[model samples]
Target: MNDRRIPGPLRRRPAAASLAAVALVALAATACSGKAEEEGGGGGGADGVATDIGVSDSTITLGALTDMTGPYATLGASVTQAQQLWADQTNDAGGICGRDVELVVRDHGYDAEQAVSAYSETSSQVLAYSQFIGSAYVNTVRERIDGQDQVLVLPQAWSADLLGSEYIQMVGSTYDLETINAIDFLAEEFGLGEGDTLGHVYFEGAYGENALAGSRHAAEELGLSVAEQRIAPTDEDMTAQVRALAGDGVDAIVVSAGPRQAASVAGVAAAAGLEVPIIGNNSAFAPQLLDTGAGPALLANYYVASPALPIGAEEGTPAELSAAYAEAYPDDQLDNGVAAGYSAISLLGQALEAACEAEDLTREGVAQAMLAMTEADNGFGIAHDFSDPAAPSSTESYILRPDADTPGGLTVLGDPFTSPLTDSYTRE
Candidate 1:
């Protein structure tokens, strides 16, 4: 649970000597094929694989625009480190597409301006973005990434607003769907139905607003009521918000903000004698929170809904990744971010390998390869279909309750599930 900030941009490349030999061979094979040179900024490799901006004879570059000094600073650090570990493992296993994978990381500190600036600065150098962390920031450059550049971008944010872009790959269920599942879990827990009211406290941005949409839809379907409280990302103290929800007599509260906000909501609500179930989206809970003052309250009443299995899940991939991540960074705390970051890049690596097999490693090639993937699984207890650009990878979410004794501080309440209500959800 190191809360230290990463000061500047960091670049990482796998150090494998075999990559040099592979590069020499590619250069030799493409020496006479000047057609790649004539076609803008690409070249041919050993397997006649076409190369582009991020792809070279020996390396393929990807970008990671993350938040290391802002609201999700600690989570962002774990995710970034996990991606780096994935890169190392991929290189060790004979690099993808006959080249080593390199990650060029930029920390945007969760500022919109800094996010856009980081994207602008690194977009040209990388073949695609492996990890873009913010919803609004990604939206700001959606047109450019989807229309102009047409490079594949796997975003860490899961707003339904990000869907339908041909090149933007969403790995998990969107925020809205995740919220629907969370609200349902809460309702079922409290045995509330038609007459119950739920309070939703969320950030005033793409991420929170998207989840709020879910709460509204769930309310409509389940014949319930929703009371909304929108707050900025900087508003950490939840005393006022909790009291407002308490005044509304909400049976349960849905929080779609960061861990700080979630903790505040739990602490304030418990202190105010506002005894109601509290739920949050995937990014809302962190393992370190169990060591805080709100730990008991969270363990008693808080729940989280996530699109993927957490690091503590007793699944094959989660088990493997948890071990690898711990070994890679012994001092770092185990969290779902490690699982998320690895999953995102592992999927991207699959696309890269597919592009190489298609003999076109250009941005367009990688994008097409991704779209063509009808079935993809990273062994995270769920299967994803990338064939549809208008829909998210999956509609299923794993409902979890906080447990102080759990490895990741949360335990799955049941198997991953897709609510029947999800089928009626229309992506907006």
Candidate 2:
């Protein structure tokens, strides 16, 4: 649920209509907001480091800016709720290292200009900056804020681009790992091994191109072949693309597209009797993406490359997050982004807890706490030991064939593609 009471200093804006609304990747942060928190009493540093959560003289303010009310409103709301829940819980627990957690959220409506404005407005006002940002937006902000030493937990994933940057360190698996993980699942489980042609469909832009690049690298490493095609974001009908791919010798299908586009592809594929199993990125789970509301037609014969824990899975600490959010938000029907957002929070919360106890809660203290961690028991064990952001992925992806065997989708296979934690891109 969106906190209605935004600080008056932050401004809101109506955004221009846009496309490329998709799912994203995660964390890397630093800062001590609440000038008071910066100058507050320090807690005991058992290991010579201050925790991400520490006691401030008055309050520990956490600054955030998100695309909460625009094209990507669904995911934005979830991230907003989950983040606030983290603050609420931390506050309830007597605060991080003793300071009461204060969360401040700003809406950017998916606009770069507005995002930077919000960033500038909320800058230095909190202990750290954590928010959901898209690829282009991140690209826009990265260069501008490159010189700041404050930690900014990225709530979205962008593969190796942000992970490798000296200025940013992410907390989740990259799209490169995500795509390969999906392919690995298809190959091993169904026996679509070497010599198999993995058919793919993607949006005709950077999002798709990057995902395709990952697939190419993974396919080569696995000795698999691929046949690719492109779809314009403006096209609502994918019958032509489906017929074309099925007509070719394409085997399995992977979709690197958003909600509306991917749904069209799935619909067309099913209509044409294109039984080749369909695969998609996490973007497929967006609000208008999956035709979950269209009943079985929208639900059957497809799988998604998940970036976070599945919705149907067990409810651990992450599930009981900010009560206000869980009680106020209405995304249970579209919980993919919600789960991903919460999982991202879970990772950050743990890191923050560790950081708060450190001798220094500065940028270096937080980064060291994050990198030093190898065994993070975050709820479902989906991202265990994801300590190195430079490596991009600490865990792989699982298959959610919800439309395949079960009505609500079943995990027919688990961790199909465990990505490498090393620093090299594979070439066939």
lDDT of 2 at 398: 58
Q: Assess candidate 1 and give its lDDT.
A: 0.82
lDDT of 1 by residue, 1-428 (tens): 11121212211121111123233432343333333224336767777898777787899989999999999998899889999999999999999888999999999999876776777667677888889998777777665676556778999999877777788888988888889878767766687679889899999878998899889999999988898999999999988888888888899999999998999999999999988899999999888988999998898889899888888878768888888898999998898888889889998888988998889999899999888887788888778888777777887788888887766777878777766666576644
Prediction 2 TM-score vs. true: 0.76
lDDT of 2 by residue, 334-365 (tens): 35555666666656666667876665565446
Model 2 lDDT, full chain set: 0.58
Location of the lowest summed lDDT over 10 successive residues in candidate 2: 7-16
Task: Superpose all Cα atoms of candidate 2 onto the true structure and report the RMSD in Å to 1 decimal.
Answer: 10.1
Off by over 4 Å in 1: 1-40
Number of the predicted model whose lDDT against the real structure is largest: 1
lDDT of each: 0.82, 0.58
